[model samples]
Target: MQQRFETIEQYLEWMGNNNFTNMTWDIEATGLLDETSIDYTASPYKIKPSYKHHCIVVEEHGGNILAFYDGPTYVFDGREYTERLPKASSMLHTEEVVTLKDYTPVEYIHLPLKEFKNYVLKRKIKRVVAHNMINFDLMSMKLVEDMDFTIGVEHRDGGLTTWSADTWMGKQVVFDDTLVISKTCNPDLFGGHSLDKLSRRAGGDTKIDFRKHLAPDVRFLDFAADMLYYCIYDVKANTAVWHWLQDHEDYQLSDRDNYIKNWLSPIQLEKKVAEIITYQEHRGFVLNVDLCEKAVKDLDAKMEERRARVEPVLPPRPATKKFMADYTPPKRQFKQNGEITSYLQKFIERIGAQLKEGDDRTMIFEGKEYKLPLPADVPLKTEMPAKIGDTTHIKQWLMGEFGWIPSEWKETDLTVDQKKIKLPMENIVAKIDRWLDVTYSTAYKEERLDGFGDYMKITPRSTRAYVRQRLIDRASKGSCKVLTNPSFTKGQEKEMCPDLERIAEQFPFAKDVIEYLTFKHRRSAILGGGMDWDEMEDGEEPEKGYLASIRQDGRIPTPADTCGAATSRMKHRKVANVPRITSLYGAELRELFGVGDGFFQIGYDFDSLEARKESAYCDQYDPTKEYCKSLMMEKPFDVHTMMAKRISEIIGRQFNRSPAKNVKYGLTK
Candidate 1:
């Protein structure tokens, strides 16, 4: 390893004063593979981390070699033994607390890890620092301090959570230096925000990549020095970044009260506000379970009525069971394959479209007066599961059978008996030979069979990736033009399919489906919170994902990710189950989080938050700024109606407001 860190004596001599605990630390430890795990080779997450016999390297500002570990001793196999960790005369270090028989003992003096707890208490170490201290290191060190010691995580910040434990040290703050780096700089410099990467930024290295050093055959003590060195090297790197933030940016690592008002810069002030917002979000909003349940149930009932209304316009599900039993998939066609040919071909032929030269793959299907190409988009997928009325099956059947062009429809989650289901992507698994990667795919099946199950299942495609949009575009070929195809992005709010919306303009059935889908999506939101954790009947497991994410105080915490290392754009994290309460569509859903008995909730929304932000940047917040004139408040002129009026002039037909609205938004299509 590279010797990039200052020696123990050299660092202590130069230790400087800083508020919020100048004590930065890091640890390296051995973890036990769970007994249930079939003999190692498991994923890193599966390893049951005990952090046994570890290296906990601490660096404090007002340093005196910890002021406690000087007389520290080690306990092995229940009896006490003196530590023999190889370090400078001033530092007491030991990587393992194993018996003499287990470890290779050398003639050296070290301290017992048992002294760690006492050291913290004696020195009154209220706050400590480490990169990713919340998840791994803090828990491990606490165990060594006292095997049964517990640490409470104050807030879970994805991997960047902050933890605290009320020790004799008076509730020490295990500060994550990673968070400091994230808020202070642009992440392009060091993208992952990992300790190793951060060390590199400080003209240093992580002395040892502990992950690579711990070979299965190697004993824990085999690389003790390397682990200790790594921790020491990292603490210096961690402290260096903290010191830099203090000196250069004039930022405080401590709480809000300690921050100097005069020292705050615009960005720093924003970060300070972000910190408070993060804390507020951590506190979470109150949830009225009864109110939410009633509203969600109302949405479901409304959807059910709409489903009943949509049913009359829909065709019967294709008899996939009969097709599965009687018909065989096509023999892999020359240079291609059509496994679904026979079943869907019947519909194409029924439309009076003759096959082109006995080729089922290429034939124009006539719709009213227009003719469209057969298989206009995408090559044949190797396999289509022979399931009747599967989402893909129903959608394809609708487009093919009716010669219908879709418009303005949003993709709604399909459930089998009210639960989302996924089938194994069996064909891909069969082509394992073509895929060079075997680590996540075809690893020894019997050895890690359970892990393999995870790979076999396909993540069901959202409608944006589904085939219906292409069909909609192809069908719009004769006289009609496709508005846009459906699309889905993770953070964006717009979900309407313009193609579906435009198609629905002429087709009554399409409009019904669009409305049905909108309500269906709202209804689906309730399923994730079908049950609450508070209602668990004694020892009963309330089916996975069914339980509500409510807190003891009946609140649903939507943890905010205020400032990322790469971007300062704030977002509510882990909100997969929580619908966007701030949205106009979710107005009713938003009210479920009541103002409680005493307070009145005065709610308001920005006219165009992003647009206004940009306008602010250029000092053009004028309402007359043409781009800001339409759709977004400031008189509420409809961009959609204007587009529809222009479209009507071109097409020579009266256009309605509903489909036009979808066309203007759902721009993703």
Candidate 2:
């Protein structure tokens, strides 16, 4: 500590505010007293010896000295009681009673605990500020639950004031921010085990890291956005008050890395937290049905399986009511409403997935399946007198002796002649016990044992269908009412054709044909023209919407009639792009090829010229035409054969066979 008082007046002023002592340090009969003696000040405000050694040293500039003890009553166990003591002060402070009504329950499920602690410590903290702290405070304090406490006493006016029950110490506090005395305090005396200390209990050596465990990017401020109700301590009023911390983006707490942060962010979680508190405050604890069932079923299956493996027909009597009643199953109780059944159901489902179905047979459920072995027989004294060790040998010996029958048949088959049947997993233990009793009069042999092998060897891949079925089963059980997956049901497609027809009926001119020829095929008389459909404008129409028309009932429309008229143009212009033809075969083929001086063009010209010359003078025989009379003298041309051969060549190439190989001509050589 550092002391800085320029003048004596300044030093005295400083001394008045702080509970420090100087030259005025006095030795009262009870002990040493600092200038100002307050109740419980020594225990609550005084520094511990360990911390005093390492606490920031006070230079001449600043230091704080709490009331201290010097003379002490040495009244120990059997020691000489010779010590000085201080006389009692006439005035004493009374303890206040805290009631449940005094506290305002924390409205928000999630809180920025670190920031809350800092807020408390920012100015000053005195005695524990809790209402009905004897009970309600204790319950609320359990919410954050990572703090420690120790007993301490308060002193006032140099006398013993009051005995503080539990002083809280840590970055944790519970406050019913509404009532003045409704709060629990955790004083951070020693550091290590405070609420800030991390524990390794969750895993082998690593603590469950909230930062790694929870979703990132979430904060307490985000949770407070929808706070239901909460409380804050009014240090000035020395009272707790209630209000919602909702929508307070500015009031963010620091160091948020935990499930509490993430779990509380959702709106539903906020309601759940509050409901749980309310329920707990009303009810003590909850009953967990699922945990109870699982424990009982697991133990029963194992016991049954063990009994099924032994042999030789030793049978134990049926389980009695007294034995069954002695078994106390595990229980789990939800601390919240609307949670008990759902939680129990989920737990049951998980347990069923993990449990063995029955003795000596496998069962299939939800794709993954299980098989349970019969329990080994643990023979009671009434059933068999042989010790457990002897039973093992008895079972093996009987199995070897009964090698005449297969193991399965011997174990399960009914022997009508003998009027008996080996019962399941029980046969192994019962028969073994019987044999051991006959073979041994005393203790039997014990053998070296090895560890058990892995119990789960098969893991079924969970298919979509299996999950869907399981969900259906859960729904059938009345456990989950909502079908979370949307695909579980089919959606109906809506019809659009009716709406399209309605629009078409409103535009009447669009129903005609060839009515678009005017504007659609407009040609300039002076110059070959172009029709432009792009230059159209949209205009207002009836209540339905915008409309357009084109060519207006078969009359040619100029640019003036074309405003929105083009809509009907496309309707009647459906056949406008067809081609027209006026030429004969050779001329049409030449035009089709679009060739200049090409073979088709030349052929068309020769055919036309020869046709004209023949028609001109062929009334009987023409002197104007030279019909190639020389060709008559030459061998007659076999045009048909040539044409046939050409056709055959084309067909052969197409069919991929040889024309020459398939064709025959008489005396062609």
Best by lDDT: 1
Off by over 4 Å in 1: 1-23, 26-57, 61-177, 187-191, 196-267, 309-502, 505-507, 529-547, 565-567, 575-585, 616-669
**Where's the lowest-lDDT run of ten residues in candidate 2?**
52-61
How many clashes would you count in candidate 1? 11
Candidate 2 residue 455 C-alpha distance from true site, Å:
11
Report the number of the highest-TM-score candidate. 1
Tell me how candidate 2 scores on lDDT. Answer: 0.24
Error of 2 at 391 (Å): 22
lDDT string, candidate 2, 274-355, tens digits: 3343333232212223333443354345434433332223334333454433221124423344233443334335434333
Candidates in order have lDDT scores of 0.42, 0.24
lDDT (10s digit) by residue, model 1, range 520-618: 444444444322221222223322221255654555555554444233455444343334655334677656665457878776767656544544454
